[model samples]
Target chain A: MPTEPLAKRPGGRSARVQAAVYQALTDLAGERDVTRLTIPAVAERAGVNPTTIYRRWGTLQALLAEVAVARGTDAPPSSSGDLRTDLEAYAVRTLADLTRPGGIAFFRAEVSPDIDERRSGLRECLQRATAGLDMVLEASRGRGETPPPAERLLDQIVAPLYFRVVFSVPDTDEAYARALVADLFSGTWHSAVELH
Target chain B: MPTEPLAKRPGGRSARVQAAVYQALTDLAGERDVTRLTIPAVAERAGVNPTTIYRRWGTLQALLAEVAVARGTDAPPSSSGDLRTDLEAYAVRTLADLTRPGGIAFFRAEVSPDIDERRSGLRECLQRATAGLDMVLEASRGRGETPPPAERLLDQIVAPLYFRVVFSVPDTDEAYARALVADLFSGTWHSAVELH
Candidate 1:
C-alpha cells in the first residue's frame, strides 16, 4: 500500500489554503461591512499567516475580485434548448443571486477602482458572467433561430436588473423580470410605444 | 438708484457662497481623486471658512449630493413634439453629460453610501434626471398616441447608458445611444430577436 502525505498530494496544501482563505473572507464579509475588512482579520479566521494572503493576492481588492470571479463563473444554468425558457430562468437566477447576502459587495468589488481596468480582472469576470447567455444564444442559432446580439441581451435584460438593484427601484420583482423577457420576445417594448 | 449691498440682495451672500463652493468642489473633483477630497480643501478654494461649510452641508457627502442635484435639475431639453427626435436628443445628451469631466464623480456622489437612502438625496436626483423623459411621454399621450410607461423608457434607454458608464464598457458612443433610441421606437429590439 502506498500512502501520500496530505500536504504532498494533488488536491493538497496549496488548494486547501486557498479554499480556507476564500471561505474565511466570505464569512467575514457577511458578518461585517466590506469596507472595514482587512487581510489580518481574514488570515486569523483562516488560520494562516497574513503574509501568505498578501503574497498570493497582492491586495484586498484583488482577493475580493477573485472571489467574485469564482462565484460568477460557477456552472451556468444548463440550457433547456428553448430560448425563452433559458432566458427567463437565467434572468430569474441572476436577480436572485444579486440580492443574496454579500452580493452587492461582490459586484462592487468587481467594478472597484483597482480592478475595473479594461484588460484585467474586470474583463475576465464580465466574460465569465456572460458565458451562459452566449451559450443560450449559440444554441438558439443552431436550432435555425436568429438570436439577438449578446449586447442586446445585456442591454435589455441584464442592465435593467443591475440598475434597479443599484438605484433601489422598488419594482424589480420576478414579475418584472418576466415582463422584460415577455416584452422582448413579443416584438413590442411597451404598448404605449406602439403608437410610434 | 438701488443702493443695496450685495449681501442684502436677492441672490446675495449665501447664494454666492453656495455657488462658489459648488464650483470649487467640482473643479477639485475633476483635478483629483474623489476619495482624497476634504472639506478644508473645498473651503480654502471657495474662500470660505471651514466651519461655515460644515454648518451648511453637514458632511462632504451632503455637499457632493447637493452639487449633483443642482446639475441634474438644470432645464430639461425642450420637447420637439416628435417622440423619436426628442428621445434621440435626450439620449445623446445624457450619454455626453455622463462622460464629461467630473461627471462620473457626480453620478458616484448621487449613489454613494451615505446618500442612497430612499426618500433622500437619491430620490431627488432620480426625479430630476427623469423629468425630461416624463415630459416627452406626456406630450406623446396628448397627441393621441399611446406612450410607454416612464419606467420602460428608464429600463430600455436610461439603464444601458449608466451601465456602460459604470462598467467602462467601450462601445458607449453617440451611435450606440442613437441605436438604443431607434430600437426602442422601432419595436424590433434586434434583427435577431425577431425570429422568436
Candidate 2:
C-alpha cells in the first residue's frame, strides 16, 4: 500500500479529514486528469462525508486549488556556493517537478481564471511556490551581491519556464535555464530594491 | 444582437451551427466563470442540440479548448520598422489584450492538461500567437541583426510578460515593455549581427 499521508499528521478528526482529502486528491490526481475529480469521489476515498467536503471546499475548483496549494513548492536543490549553478539547478528542478504526478494538474488547474476570485489562496500558494527561490535571492542580497530585480528575474528566468510550462513546447532543460541566467546577466535591467 | 464570429467564413448549415456555438461560447465566457458553463447551457445559448455538442465536442473541456484556439492569438501591432519600438508595442498590445473581457478566460481554459491530449491544436494556437513575433525575428535575421537566439527571447522578453499575465501582478505597462526591450538591447546576448 502507498504511504498514508494523514497518518503523518497529528491526531484529530479535522486533521485526519485534511490528510485524507489531500492524500486522496494527490493519488487521484496522479491516476487521472483533475477534471474527472469530483467531491463525492474524494469524499468516498477519504472516508469522509461528501457534505463536509462540499461545505469546506465549496466547489471542485476550490478543493483542488487547496490541494495544489497543500502540495507546495518542493524546495529547490540545496544551494551550492555558486549562484549560477544553484539557480540553474533550481530551474531544472522546477521543470522536473511538473512531470511529477500531481504537479501538472496543480499548475494547469491553478492557471484558470475561473478559479481566480474563488480561490483566494492563490497569492499564498504562489508565495509558497517562490519561497525557495526567494531565499536564494535573499542569500545573495545578504552577501552584498546585487541580485537581479524581481521583475527582471520574472522576465528572464521565471517567465520562459512558465511559458514553456503552459505551452508544453520547446524544451526547458539545463541549457535553457543557464541561457536565461546568462541573458539576464548580460543585460542592465531596471534598478530594483532587494526583497525586504 | 451579439456579434457573430464566423459570419465572414464560408456558408453552410454545418458552418452556421459552428458559428452559433462558437459565438455563444465566446459571449458566455465573457460574463461568467467558465467552470460553471455546461453543455446544456451552451447548447441552449447556441440554439443547437446538446447531443450534437456532445457528439462533436466530446467534453466541456474539449469544446472550450477549441473555442480558445478559435479565439486565436490577436495579431500584433503594425510595425514601424524600428525593431525596439515595434517589439515593445507588440508586448504592450499583448498585455492590453489580456485585460479584455474574454482574453484571460481563453488562456485559462487553454492550459488544462485534459484537453492537451485532445487538442493537438494547442501548438497551432501558440504558433499563431507567436507568428507576429516570429516575423520580427525573421525580419531581423534578414537585416543581418544577430538578434538574440529564440531561447533568449523566450526567457528574457516573452516569459516576463507571460509571468505577469498568469500571476496578475506587477504592472506590465508600455513603460515596462520599453524597459524589457531596452534591457535586451543593452545585452551582448549572442554574437555580432548589425541591426540595420
Candidate 3:
C-alpha cells in the first residue's frame, strides 16, 4: 500500500497577506521602532490594500503577533546526540537570528508595549522556544545523558543568551555555551532520566 | 577618629535638579511610557523650571541615563560565603524590585529605546550587575564549595534567574535555585581550570 502525501492547508489570500505583512514588519524594523509601524504604512510598503491589511489583522499588534510566530517557525531543530554540540548549535543559531538586522529591534518592540495582548504574544513565543530546548535536553537524556532538571537547564543555559541579546550586550559566545553543557553534564550524566 | 561631614560640592544645584528629574521620571513611569515623556512635563511634575532640567541634564536621554544609574546603585551585594543562600537572597530581592509598581515598566522604557545613548545607560547597569555576580562567584570558589569554570556559574546559576526576572516571568523559587547550585557544584565546579 502506498502512503498518502501530506496535503497543504489552504491558506489562499490570508497566507499571501500574512507574508506581505511580515515583510513590512521586517522592513520597518531596520529603520524604526516596530510599535510606531502603522497598518497603512505596512500596506503601502507591501503593495497590499490598507483595508485588506486591517480586515485581516484587525490591529498592528495582531499583525505583529503573527509575524513573530512565523519568524520562530523557520528555525530548524538541532539534535546531534551530543548535548554540548547541540546546545552550542542552538546558541549560535539563536545568536545569529537575534543579531540580524531586524531581530533585536523586533524583540524590543514586543516587550515595550504595556498592553496585555501584545505581551502575551511575546510570552507565547518565549514559551515555545523554551519548550523546544526542553525537547533537545530530553533527546540528550534518551541517548544516555541524564541531565539536571528542566528548570536548571533553562536557568543556567538558555536564559543568559537571551538576557545578553534582549538587553543589547555581548553575544554569549561558543566557548561559554559549550562550557555550560560540560558543567551540566560532568558527573551527573549517568543520573539523567529521559523526560517523557 | 570622628570625621567632619563631607563638604558640599559647588555643583549642588545641578545635583538637586538631577534628583528632581529622576523623581519625576519615576512618578511618570507609573502612568506613561518613558519614550514619550517630555522635559516640560517632567519639570512641571518635578516642581522645577523646565530650563533647569534642560540646562542641567542637557537632554532627555542624558537625564534618563542618570536616573537609570541611580536606580541601580542600591542593589545589595551578594557575598555571604554561602553561594546558594546569597544567590537566593539576591534573586528574591531582584524579583521584588522587578515586580514592584513601575519597576519593570521603568526598565522597559530605558532599555527599549532605539537610540544608542539611551541603551548605553542600560548596558552600564548590566555590566555592574554582572560584575557584582562575578564577585559573588569568586567568593564561593574561595570557600572551595564552587568548582572552577567561572562561565558555568554565570550560564548555569545566575543567567536563568536574570532571564526570568527581565522577561517578567514567574520567579525561580528557592528550591529550584538550590538545585541549580547543587548541579553546578557537582558537575562543573572543577572543570573551569581544566578548560583553560
Find the candidate with the highest DockQ and give its number: 2
In angstroms, how far off is B6's CA in candidate 2? 9.3
TM-score of 1: 0.79
lDDT for each residue of candidate 2 in B79-137, tens digit (9 for 90 to 100): 57667776777667666666566666666666655645624545765666577677777
Interface RMSD (C-alpha) of each candidate?
5.6, 3.8, 4.2
lDDT of each residue in A29-90, candidate 1, tens digit only: 66534545789999999999999989878778678877866666565578898999988987
Cα lDDT for residue A55, candidate 1: 80
Q: Candidate 1's error at A3, in angstroms?
A: 30
DockQ score for candidate 1 = 0.27
Cα displacement (angstroms), candidate 1, residue A119, comes to: 6.7
What is the lDDT ranking, best to worst?
1, 2, 3
lDDT of each: 0.74, 0.67, 0.64
Please list the residue runs of candidate 2 whose C-alpha ends up more than 4 Å from where it truly belongs after superposition. A1-13, A47-49, A73-82, A112-119, A190-196, B1-17, B47-52, B73-79, B115-119
DockQ of 3: 0.30
DockQ scores for all the models shown? 0.27, 0.45, 0.30
For model 3, name the residue pairs that clash. Answer: A146-A192, A156-B155, A156-B156, B147-B189, B148-B189, B149-B192
Best by lDDT: 1
* Candidate 3 lDDT, B56-92, residue by residue in tens: 6666656655666667778768577777666666555
